[model samples]
Target chain A: MLTLAQQLWIGLTNGMVFALIALGYTMVYGILELINFAHGDLFMLASFLALTLVGLLGLATASGPVVVVGLLGVVLACAIFAALINRTVDRVVYRPLRNAPKLAPLVSAIGVSFVFQNLGLFWGGLPLDVMGGGLAAAAPKSFPDLIPSTNLLGDGAAFRITAKDLVVIGSSLCVMVALWLFVTRSRLGKAMRATAQNPLAARLMGIDVDRVISATFLIGGALAGFAAVIYGLYVNTIKFQDGYQNGLYAFTAAVLGGIGNIPGAVVGGLVIGIVRALSDQYIGAQWQQAVVFGMLIALLVFRPQGLLGANVREKV
Target chain B: MLRVEQARAGYGAVEVLRGISLTVDEGEIVTLIGANGAGKTTTLHTLSGLVQLTGGRITFLGENIAGVPAHELVRRGLVHAPEGRKIFSRLTVLENLEMGAYTRRDPDGIARDLARVFELFPILAERRRQAGGTLSGGEQQMLAVGRAMMARPRLLLLDEPSLGLAPLIVARIFEVIRELSKSGVTILLVEQNARMALRLAHRGYVMETGAILLADAASALLENETVRAAYLGE
Candidate 1:
């Protein structure tokens, strides 16, 4: 039987991963009030790009220091790539339909999600060595075990803490703290919060609403990109369908925390992660997803504003 | 400094501003007085570029700006303190005031204006850290007007500033409007309180349906028998 500490550790690490993606969902929802369904596929495509970069740079066999530098390069490149793509998608797909019926952009987001999935499928078929030599597009690709998984707590400890897990949790914490400071302290961040509260009022104050929205997509996408890299490293595997599963979990976290609330997303993600870990160990692996979603539905029904959300009436 | 000629606009297919024309010269309080559904708010929205003009020429500071975006208009010093006092309710009073200066770059000028706004409404200064929504309706109206003033507008548009407030609050709001006008800010005031509006304005236009039915000096409009009966609630 696993110790309680081990279960908590596993859950905390997994929760951090979900938190990264959840931030993207919550930020976009906060600004535009539109769920960017395509976000998951975006993260999937970013992982594929990261794999391609790893192969191109031949970093798989490089020395330790070189590998570290190359990994940093991959994270930065993927972040910029994802941020630009998200901004373009917003400009082309979302901006025109902004004033249309609310359902219009949502439908467009679903369509974009499908498009991104197909793109991921196509990317997996490219003749890249990192993608299992592109032999089968539908096959799950194995990400090289770049980070050593030696137990940091010594060989016989009941709780196993690895460097990979530490890196994943540490990096996520850094990003979250940075984001908190940015949203609370920066001028543009304040403008974004204002825009989220009232677009008309922000515009009246001479804030460029379009620019702010674009910045939101950019920041959200960058977080997804960062999460994609961490996920690839932690799981040692990538699949086209992983985006759908992971994205669903992140979306659930956002809703559980309070759809538009930032801190709420983080708390919701951790809660979901803990629930999933506990359910997998105590209940059954097959029932974990159901339990997580079931908890979400129950919480939503009882506290519609979410755990941390204040009960503000929806503006007419 | 601002002129609208034969302006036509509306929501979708229904025209709300039908060939309405008016002008406000530098340093004048131009009031548009009318009853409900007279397109007074629509006129102000069009001027602020919130509504697109299907047919019209809007010349502000000698530049044709009919199709410019609302934020761009605000940057060019056309500030509107809208009908509903649309303050950023989630933000603090100080943050709301800071947002007013979003387009401006000079910190010293902003500080000076902040001080001036505080002098004009000391209550706002007292509640600087308070969220705007927590304030009473009267205080919110003051914050809205104070926010607009932070933009250092070349022409300020005040739409129904006294709406849904007590008579004492209405009087206080009008006093600020008069004070702002005297301080050389060109204003386009839209109000249902025709008597108070005309009393404060140097010039006034009586609008009916979507067009201006009469235009003259505020004193002349106040004296007109039809104006007194229809709008002034005689």
Candidate 2:
């Protein structure tokens, strides 16, 4: 049997990663019922941009404050770029279909996913860049131990808990909590909820409905981009098409927790993360999809409303 | 003051108000009483910009406002409390009231008005923290009215506030309306309960097939033999 510390460590790091990606899925689906299929890829693309920036600026080997600031610059650039791109998606794909049939926007999302994936491939190509040979191919970047103490928790025979894991887990919790407060206490957040509940009533209340929708996409994209940067630094590498699998997993988390509900999404993420980590430990990685998808299907069968969904009476 | 000159509006392809005209003077409680599909609710909706007018003109306070967006109308102090008590279900009674005052910047004054609403309907204050959805049909209607009043509107458009409520509750609501009218707020009330409507209104319009069939003082309409037999249940 695994020690309590070891199990906790695994859960924490894995949970952090899940929470980050889960925020994207939850926020997007909250306002727009469509699952943004391109979101995961968008996160992946952000990581790639950061990696490229680091390599070009020679910040990969830079010392102390320079490396820290370089990283900040990368994160900021990625976040801004991601938000802009997300806003673009809202304007070009989602907004036009605001009054159209729902299926139209959904189909367009799938097409966007492919377009982004191919664009990444064209840039990265088949062969990885020749700088660090297989090292660059295997791991695009390695963050300095910025997380302070990776070995804070007592070590064990099987799994070693690190400061990095603690940092990841802690940050995700902070971000999620912050998001909760923003949505509940902030005016714009209430406006968003109002828009979701009754667009007509919200419009009557003087809310700019279109602006609120656009803001949702922008914020969701920025969070995803920010998560991508941290994920890259945590895992140390990301492929051009990394978003597909990550996006799918995050989407599953959103659905599991209850789409449109922020707290539910976070809970869903952590639950999925723990389940995936436990499975990875015992049942081998390949069995992951079978287990997760099976659970998802079963949940749907039993409670189609998800963990926190209100009884939806919306008819097609 | 409000005026509709040959105003026409409807749902998509289905016309509900066909060149219907009506007027309400300042501080007047004008009631439009009609059968279910006679465009009473539709007329109110079109006045508040909820229904799009296909033809004719709507002038409120001497400004053309036929095609103004619904919320914009609220901003301009023309608030609609809607047919169903469309109170935000998830929000608490207090939050729902706050949303009604979204266009206003006077927090202290808004707070004072809220106090007045609570004073007006003590039950709503008792359930201030409760979800607006949990209220009884009557309470929801009162909250809906209270919410509209929070907007500090010059003209309040109430569509069938009496719909789906006990008569006692309906009486209580009409009393609130009586109180509001006494305080100088212009009201345009639409209702299918013609007897109760005719009793409260200064002027009354009888609507049929999306057009006005007759217009007269409320007491005059109440006494008219045909109107009394057909609408007032004589």
- Among residues 3 or more apart in sequence or in different chains, the pairs in candidate 1 whose N, CA or C atoms overlap within 3 Å are none
lDDT of 2: 0.79
Q: Each candidate's lDDT (Cα)?
A: 0.90, 0.79
Pairing residues by index, what is the TM-score of model 1? 0.97
Interface RMSD of each: 1.6, 2.8
Which residue runs does candidate 1 get wrong by more than 4 Å?
Answer: A310-316
How do the residues A1-316 of candidate 2 rate in per-residue lDDT, one tens digit apiece?
A: 5654565567667666666777776776666677788888788778777666767667756786987788778888988888899889879888888777888888988999998887665545435342232343333334333334445546543657665676567666776788778877877887877777666677767677788888888778878877877787677656765788878877888788877667777777777877787777778889998888888899899987778883232221
lDDT, residue B161, model 1 = 93
DockQ of candidates 1 onward, in order?
A: 0.66, 0.47
Tens-digit per-residue lDDT, A121-177, candidate 1: 988887777785445887898887889999998999877999999999999999999
